[model samples]
Target: MSSSTPAAPITGAAPSSLCAREPHVPAERLVAEMVPPPRFDSVRFSTYIPDPNQPSQTEAVQVLETFAAGLGGAHATGAGRRGFFGFGRAAKAPKAPSGPRGVYLDGGYGVGKTHLLASLWHATPAAPELKAFGTFVELTNLVGALGFQQTVKTLSGHRLLCIDEFELDDPGDTVLVSTLLGKLVEAGVALAATSNTLPGKLGEGRFAAADFLREIQGLSAHFRTLRIDGEDYRHRGLPEAPAPYADEQVTRAAHATEGASLDAFPELLAHLAKVHPSRYGALTDGVKAVCLTGVVPVPDQSTALRLVVLADRLYDREVPVLASGVPFDELFSEEMLKGGYRKKYFRAISRLTALARDAKRLVR
Candidate 1:
């Protein structure tokens, strides 16, 4: 952009020549640094994404636009746009704009639900009532630890939530989701989420069970549903490009920011709990690097481990971890990974992505 700017010296050239460089610089870090930390203060976080999910972000916008317009039936949405992310269509039921409870994206795995949700969250800034939550499944972990009623009370305070993993694994879980969602809508909290199942898709697929539908009915009454179908994205692997927001980046940033005075996770978690009821319980090592706080209980295990995992991941260029809860744990019990860490990773990304975007500006 600026031709007048001095060109960078050729590699292996004399060191003292580069003004941006100093007398004593680590050989490793000296190699072409990340654009010299930018001039003037920048967003507390880094904005120089090696590669951004622009295409994905664009598709997400289209999905939200369709949903926002009430393009399909009010309640039931027809399969409209199909892309790398998943399926999207406008719904018409409830007779209300998608604004009431936000847009609910429901469908099978390998669909671009999370990608779509991220797009919607980033673009729908005009609707202040539409608060985009990073993940919905994490709320479940909290609900299991804390009573659901209180969690609802907290979340009802917010206007919107962008939740991922909408399906409830436990039956008791369904009731909590039902009650919490019902109250939120009554109190005017619009909602949105990306899921691998349909509204009544949670319960037994065997009979298209009635009870599941009933529970989903109350919540469904206030919001609309969209189904994504077609070939699973997983059938094909992702292409290489700009580095993704790796858990490592989050952990690295968190660690880099560690010190006497800093914005801690407590505040972030509390805000989240007030919006969603599922985050709870705490780990023994109060030294956790990351965590979702402000729930009835706390997080299980130590919050630090998630940070550690993220920290290790931060250095890895292959799989970038954009967002994370805690960067403390590197090793997830095989069970945790199989059960829902897969789901949790997406949740982390959604959360971090929101946090990063919400910031005034990104720094080195």
Candidate 2:
């Protein structure tokens, strides 16, 4: 058996002398000082945890953590200080996980796939860490904006990554994703992802029903694959959208400040929210930015209140807006009313449409 000793104090006093060096650590501090987190700086350690405080992407953040922690040798127990992401070191470093490490999370719309993917992103630790982006288009879009080499470097830059809602419904995206994944995975990055499809099935226009399978297999081979099967947690039905609209707030807020006409929209919204300090869920695109005010499917909400008010005010002031959504003017007609809940739905839809009518002068 080995014995442990307290660290000596920083004082210059000699050990065992009159001012004999006091133990470096106080008895009170010993408990904390005794435990070192399981992983080192190079390797991250994490466990499944509820989303913390306020999140930029609520569901996505939590789901991602659960997936990455699943990769751990032993489920991470709450312990000492963890690395930046809190993911423990790989049972083995750099080596891929046994069986499969990739998860194919597919289901009806509304399942927390995005949330799961986001959590995985938070749990990953890359050198500079890979940049986390939403949607499949973003993967290749990065290639377009930064070029293939830089994109590969970005993925290589971080060993951990999560791509939210991957697999676009386009052949162009398919080609880019097919190519991008091969290079990114080959570059030594570990990826945990979520999609709306089963393994081998890619969402591309006119894809070789069979070759699509090959394309996925190509990527899946680079990492292990698991299907996150379950029901869609996202609420959906034959009618009206959800309120305060937790999901739509992000989407619509994106529409509010997008484009050249509303150049001052961001500052105006920020200043307007000075007293309240609202979380408008702004999405950053390098230098370009878009707030989520106008992205909501249903316009009634206090969530993106500031942005919506601004969008409405902008329209009143003749600030041309351009976006894509079924304007309430058209969406809530007698044809739509035939479907029902016209009262509550119409109020929200009309408000959103009014913003569109004001901001998007040129049919968004």
Candidate 3:
């Protein structure tokens, strides 16, 4: 629960509240927003700073650059120019390229896999509309919203599809995406994905990928996995996150900053439950900063996972977060930290810590 006392209200501008938003994202908007989020919007291969000690990082860049080059001319146009939802007249399907149809980046978090992935999205010789980049969750959500067949029809004409943070925890999602990818591959679409787990090693602790070996094997055959080894780059040499601010300070900062959303942490979590996870990005639309009071450890797994999605969306939009109470690192319980979703929790902490640091400038 948050503190009872409220901070003094601002004189001029009023702060927005995330708890007040219940964004409704239409299917067309979902299709449009599939491109890279703001954080990586302009990131190109040249911008990636590889760790000199990690040779594989550089090797990945070289291999991906060649891979992008190979997808030139005929591959880029994808048989013919198609409008949104595959409306344009179709031409003969291009000859499917021999060898691997895609690249899979297998590495630990903060190893620049996403940066490399987005760079490949940018480097590929295709118009922005012809290439798509999004998180694995977003991809699944699109399927849920548009239906599997509609999704295939929508993306099959695309030259490339890049998925980040590919998850293998849910056996259903693993199988669903595997079948989806098979259809897309056969349509001559190139693919690239980033994940902490290797394709063959997916679903190790949670569910057995071997149970669906035929589907998993078909998906794996399309990708040439590149192993990148490195430490978490976000904290490589950065200072520790600034300590949490007082509740009054956070609220005051929120009111003073334009386009900021102020909310009690618990209340915000409750609000998230009512909104679909697919609309999380839309929920944060135009929110320049996020301010919360009574920040505490998440109550349960479901709530914690929702927070992870929200954190990813906020980080994608480069929205700084100002908060009071427990630090981001302590938001998950010890048992939860050691559980199957630890990577997600850790990634959330890393991103939230960075955003917290960004919020420091907003404090008086």
Candidate 4:
């Protein structure tokens, strides 16, 4: 496969290498790609099969449906008043809604929070352009790429904004996103987010929770917390992840499979450092599967976090991960897993395991 190309065809030839590709995502593409990823593109409240044992799952759906309905009424009645931007100065902004302006779905790795969040996005009555959905990392990256004020101006027009895997790992990001969301709420944008941590407890282990809370107090107050408890739906009754395949087997599968990328795990990790995390999604564009050899535990916190982002993008695209060496569970060190970023590492493991399961057929 040619290293110059972004992706190669499946022609029983040597597969493309992720390490060889550096994707450049234009700012507009970032904004345009803010909708739910392909995996949850069609998820809706009706399609979400809530665990019969978890009543909060069912309640979340009902509340979100009502929330969607409320947005419909507001949009229908106020459409004419707000010009092109929902918060134009021609008309005085209506009083901000009383009570929480958003819903925060707090739970573990796979309780279908994302499914429900996307369902709410799909349920909202506004046009597709009027609703935005993206991960916390993506949101922060957007602000970084577009500048803070511009991001606020761009999203302030939306009727609903759904943020998945909301992160409080960085103090700066917490303050930035909090202030941005506060602006959007004042403009009447309905907010919804899903996270492993609750609103009040966002930065508990990662940083000083007290300072984080103080910075985001106004934004947190706008969110109504909904706790959904359940086991990871992905692995609820599934068998344990298959053992890593041999390097030769992974390489052979890469050569035999169409639209696959072959890379040494360490080489790919090094390549990730050269490219911005915001472009990770674009890096996998047109790639059907990922095959990595010599997979081992990540060396440090920064690398592990980068791997988590890559794992997320690959999972979002439903790309099967064929890897040799360590299993997904061992990617992070024990200390790393017990640290503040534990939830992220665990979520990455769960997602990568699911993708690994998908790759089993490729090897066969």
Evaluated with TM-score, which candidate comes out highest? 4
Tens-digit per-residue lDDT, 1-364, candidate 1:
8769774432321211011111232322211221111121131112212113334433444557654443221222122221112224233333323333556676554455655555444444334332434444455544544456755655555544566656565557677778877766655454677765556455443233465678866655554666555333433343322222343344344344322112234443333333212212111112222312111212442342243223222211112222334332222444444443334433333333333332212113
Clashes of 2: 41
Steric clash pairs (candidate 4): 10-258
Q: TM-score for model 3?
A: 0.90
lDDT-based ranking, best first? 4, 3, 1, 2
Cα lDDT of all candidates, in order? 0.40, 0.39, 0.86, 0.87
List per-candidate RMSD values in Å: 16.2, 22.4, 5.4, 6.4
Please give the range of 10 consecutive residues that has the lowest summed lDDT in model 2: 13-22
TM-score of each: 0.42, 0.43, 0.90, 0.91
lDDT of 4: 0.87
Which runs in model 2 stand beyond 4 Å of their true positions? 1-67, 70-101, 125-131, 168-172, 211-213, 222-239, 242-364
Candidate 4 lDDT, 1-364, residue by residue in tens:
7668664443478899888888999899999999999999989899999899999989988888877766764442232333222332334444554467688999988899999999889998888999999999999999999999999999988888999998788789888888999888777677899999878777778887776667767667878898998999989999988899999889889999999999999999999999999999999999999999999999999999999999999999999999999988999999999999999999999999999999999985
Clashes of 3: 0
In model 2, the Cα lDDT at residue 192 comes to 59
Q: In model 1, which regions exceed 4 Å deviation?
A: 1-63, 66-102, 126-132, 144-149, 205-213, 230-364
lDDT of 3 by residue, 222-285 (tens): 7889999999898899999999999988888998898888999999999999999999999999
Clashes of each: 56, 41, 0, 1
